[model samples]
Target: MLRKIIHIDMDAFYASIEQRDNPEYRGKPVAVGYGGKRGVVAAASYEARQYGVHSAMASVTALRKCPHLIFVMPRFEVYKTVSNQIMQIFREYTDKVEPLSLDEAFLDVTENKKVMEFATQIAKEIKQKIHCQTRLTASAGVSYNKFLAKIASDYNKPNGLYVITPEKAEKFLEKLGIEKFFGVGRVTAHRMHELGIRNGFDLKQHSEKELVHHFGKAGALYHQFARGIDEREVESEYVRKSLGAEETFAEDLHELVDLLRALDDIAREVHRRAEKRGFLAKTVTLKIKYADFAVVTRSRTVVNYLRTYDQLFDIGKELLLQVDDIEERKIRLMGLTLKNAGTDQVVLTNQPLQLTLEFKE
Candidate 1:
């Protein structure tokens, strides 16, 4: 049976919230983040986007692009409150809701509580309720699967609704650029372009085996996506396998001292999240991304669950030191992750085993 999925994404969530609370910021270009030298934009208003200012862009660069851009600090508590309100609205229609972030989620409404025959109607009602309650606009997409629904949500922005029916899915994907495909990041897109795979049609020309040879495991996903087929289901109860936090710097750090300082911040963030969720793990993983986009990771499993910030930071430092020729690389991003030890034990126990027969051989 075809699933009825709806993806809801708020338009410029933080920035819009700022504009709604402060009328002075309504018509002007606004950015939500710190305005310091190393600060990055967390969100940008539509007005700021016109000046090429976007989220994750450096604050200094954003100011250079639009000198009049106003910066507002994020109010996460208020955002969470609004998120809860919207999520409650989603539950009124369907219990199968998967939140991607505070501002976006996917809902499986094939068997909706409202018993609505049309997914589009549910999407419109959800958007209307969000506007009435929060005074903020959201964009919604209705389709038969998660991938197409997400894409459709972004088709029109800032209080927009779009639907991609089963009949329209193929043509919609065929003309879509490879860069717009989910999971095709900058590195993968460049490789695909080199292989003459610029769009969905180009991608469909390659077989699954050919794609896998060039792109590894993700190649199979691309092949399926090109045909407008995704078998992934909407998981309502998400089980987190790991908890981690990462930060990207506006300027690359070359010195060990600077890297350690950045690692301290990331470690604290991971610890805070772990404590908040009551999550315990026996493995610590450190991820480093160099200025040139090369990435490396080091991990260590301990006998005991990590329960303190000191433990996390110490393990992360040891992992950092294990990297070869670290001084030669300019680091742009650093992250720390914690994995549950029991999960590994379960995998080992489930593995199939073969017995050797020396006499038969």
Candidate 2:
């Protein structure tokens, strides 16, 4: 039997919530984040996207793109509340729901509580309930597997629904751009271009052995994706691997005092989040990105779990001091992370939906 999957992606989740709550923001270009010189955009409304304003872009750059863009500080607590409401609605249909983030999730409705015969109907109902209850719209994609379902959801825009049946999956994939394939980032896509792989048809021309030699293990997955084959299941039990935060400075820092001060702030924020999430780990890692974009990291694994803010900060300070030529090189960004002593589980941070799903799968 084919597995029924539906991928639900909220349209500009943070920006939409703001618009739904505040009448003044509706139909205007809005970005959710600080507008300071050092600020980065967390989310951008579709209107703002038209002007090339997007999340992770510098606030200064976003403003340059859309001079009238409005900036609003993030309200995570309120977003979480709305997310819970959405998750409860998913539970109403199926227990096999895998949340990719606060905004999107994947539901295995093959054996749903509603005993729905068609996956498209389930996706339609879910989208309706979300809009009716929260006054925010969602786009849904339905198919036999997670990959097609995820791509289907994004096929349509806000308040849209799309389905990729088994019969159509092959032709649809053949015409799909190489960039749309799973695990294909900018760098990988560039390499594929050099090899003349522009679309799924081009990728299909390569044998698994040749692809594996080019992309290592990931090449094998690409070979499968070209054929519209994704065997991964919708995982409901997600274990967070690490917790941390990073900040990019508008101005580079070369002084030891400034670097230490920045590390202290990052350590404090990481500790606060860890405490809030009850995430405990024995290893602390410090990351440094130089003004020239060169990156380096230092880590230390202690016998005892880092439980106190002081402990996390002290370890972070030690790691920072251990970096090579820290005082000589100008630093553009600093980050702190906590993880288990000897595990290599992938970490899921707030990245683009494509990048996040790459790690989740």
Candidate 3:
């Protein structure tokens, strides 16, 4: 059976909310984030984006791009309330609604409660309901599957709706850039470009076997995407395997003291989240990203569950010290994670021998 999928994404979510609440911010360049030397822009309004100010860009850089840009601190509690409002609207149509974030979700409406024959109509109604309840706008994409639906949602953005039928999928994909494909990041896009695969048509020229030889498991996915095919389901329930917190620094830290300080903050955050969720884990992992974008992680599994901030910090410190030549490399990011013991989830670490010690009663 052909499944009807709809992907909905809010327009400049945080920034838009700020504008809606504050009339003075309307029609002006607004950024939602802390405006400090070390802060980063979490969201940029359309007006700010016109000035080349965008999310994740340095706060100082954003100021340089748009001198009149107004910065507003994020109100996460209010955002969560709005998220619940939109999710309720989604539930009215179908139960198979998968939320990707606070502002975006995918809905499988093949068998809907409204008995609507057209997916496009459902997308339109959902968008209307969201705006009516939240005074906010959303963009929606409707298609036969998830991949094309997600792409279609972005095609006409900022209070827009787009539909990609089965007949138009292949031709549309052939004209799409490789970078526009799902899961194709900067590094992968560069490699694809080097291999003369700049667009979907170029990607289609290679056989599945040839693609797999060049890109491994992801290559198989690329081949299918190029042919406008994706079999992945809309998973309504998401199972979290680990709890972690990470921070990207405004300036690289080269000193051990600075790294330890950052690690302490991250450890506290992970512990607080774990306690709130009632998540218990026996393993602690320390992750580091260098200035050159090389990532490395080290993990330690203890005899008992990690239940204290002190225990998390101690294990993270130990793992950090085991890293090779840490002083020689400038660290750009630091993170701490607590993983559930006895899970098959892959962990990238420097430890060669992983031994599990157990006591027999």
TM-score, predicted candidate 1 vs. hidden true structure: 0.86
Where model 2 places Cα greater than 4 Å from the true spot, the runs are 341-361
Candidate 3 regions off by >4 Å? 248-258, 289-296, 301-305, 325-332, 340-361
Model 1 C-alpha lDDT per residue in residues 1-361, reported as the tens digit of each score? 8999999999998899999999999989999988877677889999999999999898999999999999997787787778888888999999888887788989999999999999999999999999999999999999999999999999999799999999999999999999989999999999999999999999999999999999999999999999888889887765556778788776789899988988888888788877876677899988898988799999999998888999999999999999998888899878888886454222211111111100100
lDDT tens readout by residue for model 3, 1-361: 8999999999998899999999999999999888877677889999999999998898999999999999998887788778888888998999888888788889999999999999999999999998999999999999998899999999988899999999999999999999889999999999999899999999999999998998999999999999889998887765456778888787899899998988888888888777876667888888899988799999899987778999999999999999999989999888888887444334322111111111111
lDDT of 2 by residue, 1-361 (tens): 9999999999999999999999999999999988987778989999999999998898999999999999998887798889889988999998887888889999899999998899899999999999999999999999998888988998888788999999999999999999988789999999999999999999999999999999999999999988889999987766576778888876899999988888788887888877776677898988898988799999999997788999998999888888888788899888888888334343433222221100000
Among these predictions, the greatest TM-score belongs to: 2
Higher-TM-score candidate among 1 and 2? Answer: 2
Candidate 3 TM-score versus the reference: 0.88
Tell me the TM-score of model 2. 0.91
TM-score of each: 0.86, 0.91, 0.88
Determine which window of 10 residues in candidate 2 has minimal summed lDDT.
352-361
lDDT of 2: 0.86
> Lowest-scoring 10 consecutive residues by lDDT in candidate 3?
352-361
Off by over 4 Å in 1: 246-266, 288-296, 324-334, 340-361
